[model samples]
Target: MAFSQQLPQGVTDLYADDYELKQALTGQLQHVISSYGYQPIQTPTFEYYDLFMNVPGTMNSDQMIKLIDRDGKVLVLRPDATVPIARMVAQSQSEVETYNKFLYVTNIFRMESGESDRSSRSFSQVGVEWFDDAHPLNDIEMIVMAIESLKQSGLKNIQLELGQAGFFQSLLQEAGLTIEQQLVVQQKVDEKNEYELSRLLTQYQVNDQIKNQLIQLPSLFGSPNYVITEAEKIAVNRGMKQSLKRLVELVNQLEQLGYAHYISIDLGLVNHLNYYSGTMFQGYIEGYGKPIIQGGRYDQLTKYFDLETSAIGFGIYLDDLISIVKKQQSFKTNQLETVDVVTEEKDFVKAMEFAQELRGKGVVVNMHYENDSTTGDPVIYLSEKKVEIKGETFTFTTVEDFLTKAGFKNGNN
Candidate 1:
C-alpha cells in the first residue's frame, strides 16, 4: 500500500506513448485479420478454470493466473485464445452447419508481480481461426498475412521458420514408444536438447533408423526444397511420407504466392503433438528476444469437444511488435502531428467545433480548457487568435489558415 513499493516482475506499466502505440497497432492488426474474411469474435477475460486445466496442448497451471469466483467455481484469467475459440465453435449449436472463420484482438493474462503493470502480465493478442476448411491455402493465407502485418507495422528483417509436427508424430508412432516415453522425447526435441534425445533413444532401445532420423531432425533446416529432400530420405512410414509430401506442397504454394523468400524449413520443431496437427511456424524480427508471432494447425484439437472441425490459427504478440516499432519509428508512433487546442473561457464553443473539424480531417486533437499539458505531452495550444506549437506561436486571422498550416485540409482543395 506504500507509494514506494514496486510492482511485480514480468508485469509492466504503460504510459502515453506506450499505451497509444499498442492501441494503434491493435487496430492495424484487426484490419489485417479482417481482410482475410475471418469475422471477429470475443471471449471472456476469465472463464471456468476447467476450460484450460489439464488441456493437453496448453500452458501449465503454473503460468496461469487463477482465482475463485463467488459460486466457488475455480476461474482462470484466460492464458491463451486459440483453445477458447475452438471451444466456442464446438459449443455453437448453429443448425446451418457451415464453415466458420473467426478473428479477435483481446487481452491474455498470466500471473506476474504488478497490479498496475499492464504490459507483460496482460498482453494484447491478435489472431485468426479458420475452421472447417483444411486446404493448404488456409495455412498459406495466415502465413502471408503474418508477413504483411509485420511489414505493415514497419518491421523489417523478419524470418519465418516452418516445420511439420506430423513428421515427428509419425516417427513416434513408428517408434512404438508409450505416451510417457513419447512425451519425454518430444519435450527434449522441442527444446532442441540433442543429448537427452540421444540418451532416451539408446535407453529405450529405439530402432537404429528411428534414432538416427530423430537425431537428424533438429539439424535438418534450410532451403525449403533441400529440407524436404532430406526429410524424404528418413520418412520410412506412410505417415512420414505423407507429412513430407504436405511440406512439399506448402513450399510450392509459398513459391507460387511469392512468399518463398521468407520461407525456410525447420524440421526440429516438436510442438505438443496434441496440438499443431500439421504445419507449424514462428516469425522472428531482429532485436526481439522472442518470436513476434507463432501459430500452427490444430485440426485434431476439436476432437476433444466431440467436433470433427478442422482449424489452423496464429496469434500476434502485439506488445513485442510495439517494442520493435518504437525503436524503428519513434516519431511515427508518437502519433500523427499531435495538436492540442486550448481556448480562453469565452471561446470554448468555437474550440470544440474546431477540435471536431480537426478530427474529421484525420488529425489527433487534444482539447483542453487550459493552456498546459499536465503530463508534459507536447501540445499545440490554440488561443483566440494564435496557435502555439512547441515553443513557437503563430498568428492566424482565419480558420482556413490555421487548418492549412497544421497539416489539415478541407475537402475539394
Candidate 2:
C-alpha cells in the first residue's frame, strides 16, 4: 500500500548553503540570549495534550500534530514554546524566589500556514522567559532585549507594536456589558474594526464611558506622550489607569536606554496570551509581514502548577527569522579554505603527529589516510618526546607549536 506522493502540502526542503545560514542565525540568536544573562534550556518536543490546551488565549489543540502514547495518553508536538517554558517554571516551584532567566532555541510544529505561498511545516524558535521578576522595569528589559536581538541578527526596518492587557480588561469591566457582549466588543477591537466595536457597545446599551473607551481602543496608538494624554481621558476600571501609568514608565525607561525612537504604543493590539497579565509586545522586521519576536508578562502561571509565582517571557520564530536574514546581503559568511594533509602509512605516524599538532593549535585539519593517499605532495617531519613537527613551510609544526600559533598558550602544561 505504498504510493509515491507529494509532501502532504506545506512542507519543502532547504539545501546547500541555505543550511549554513540557519546555523549562523542560530548562533547570533544564542549570542543575544546569552548577552541578556539568559541561560539555554532544552525541553521535550512532545508533551501531554493538556500542557498547551489548558492555557486560555493559546492556540486551539486541533492545530497540534498529535498521537497516542503507550499508556493511551494523547501526546502532541508543541505548537508553541511559551507554554512549555511556563510548564518548566511551574515544575521548579522552589526557584520562584530567585530570578529565573531561561532561553531556548527549538523547532516548532504548526498546522496552519501564513498568507505567504511558501510551504512550511516545522520552524525554529529562540525564546526567553523571566520568572519572579514582575516589575515594570522587567517588561521594558524584555522589549529592549528583543529589539537588540533582532538588530544583532542583521535585520533592519523593524517596528514594535506595544499593548497592555490591563487596558482591555479594564474597558470590558467598566462597560458592564454581559460576557457575550464583551466578547463581541473584544472581537471587533482585535480586528481593528472600529465601526463594529461601536455597534456592539451600542447594542449592549453601554453608557458613554464604555462607548468612548471602545472607540478609543481603535485610535489609541502613538508616541508615549500622546498615548498617556489620551489614556487619562478613558474613564474605565482602575487597573486600566495603573496599566497606562506603567506603560508610561516603561516608555521613559526605554528612552533612557537610547532606543526611544524605536518604541510605539498601540492600544488596539489584542491577542494577549494567557500568561501575559500585563504588557505584551511584538517585533516586525523588514520583508516579513509577521512579527518575528513576541513576549510579555504572565504572573499567574505558577498557580496553575500548584505554586505561587509570577513570570513573563517571549520567543522569536528562528526559522522565519532566517528567511528574513537570508534576504539581507550582509549576513553572508566567507567560504572556509579546504586543507588536505598528505602523508603515507610509512609516514602515517608522522602525518598523525603533525595533524594532532595542528589540531591542538585550533586549525581544522583533514588527514590524507594511507588508504586514500595520493602521489601529489610528500611532506616529512621530526617527532620530539611530545613535539612532532612535519616539514618547513607546513601549516603546523609540533603539536605544542601549533597550539601556540593557534592561540592555545597552555595545554595541560
Alpha-carbon RMSD to native, per candidate = 4.1, 5.8
Which residue runs of candidate 2 sit more than 4 Å off their true CA positions?
1-5, 96-99, 113-119, 177-184, 199-209, 332-335, 339-413
lDDT of each: 0.78, 0.72
Error of 1 at 227 (Å): 1.3
Residue lDDT tens for model 1, 279-362: 898888766667788888998888877777788888888887887888777325424545667777688788787878667766
For candidate 1, the lDDT comes to 0.78
Candidate 2, run of 10 with poorest lDDT? 379-388
Q: How many residue-pair clashes does candidate 1 contain?
A: 3
Query: Best candidate, lDDT-wise?
Result: 1
**Candidate 2 local lDDT, 149-239, one digit each (tens):** 8888888787887888878887778777776566567767877898878887788888886787788887888787887788788845679
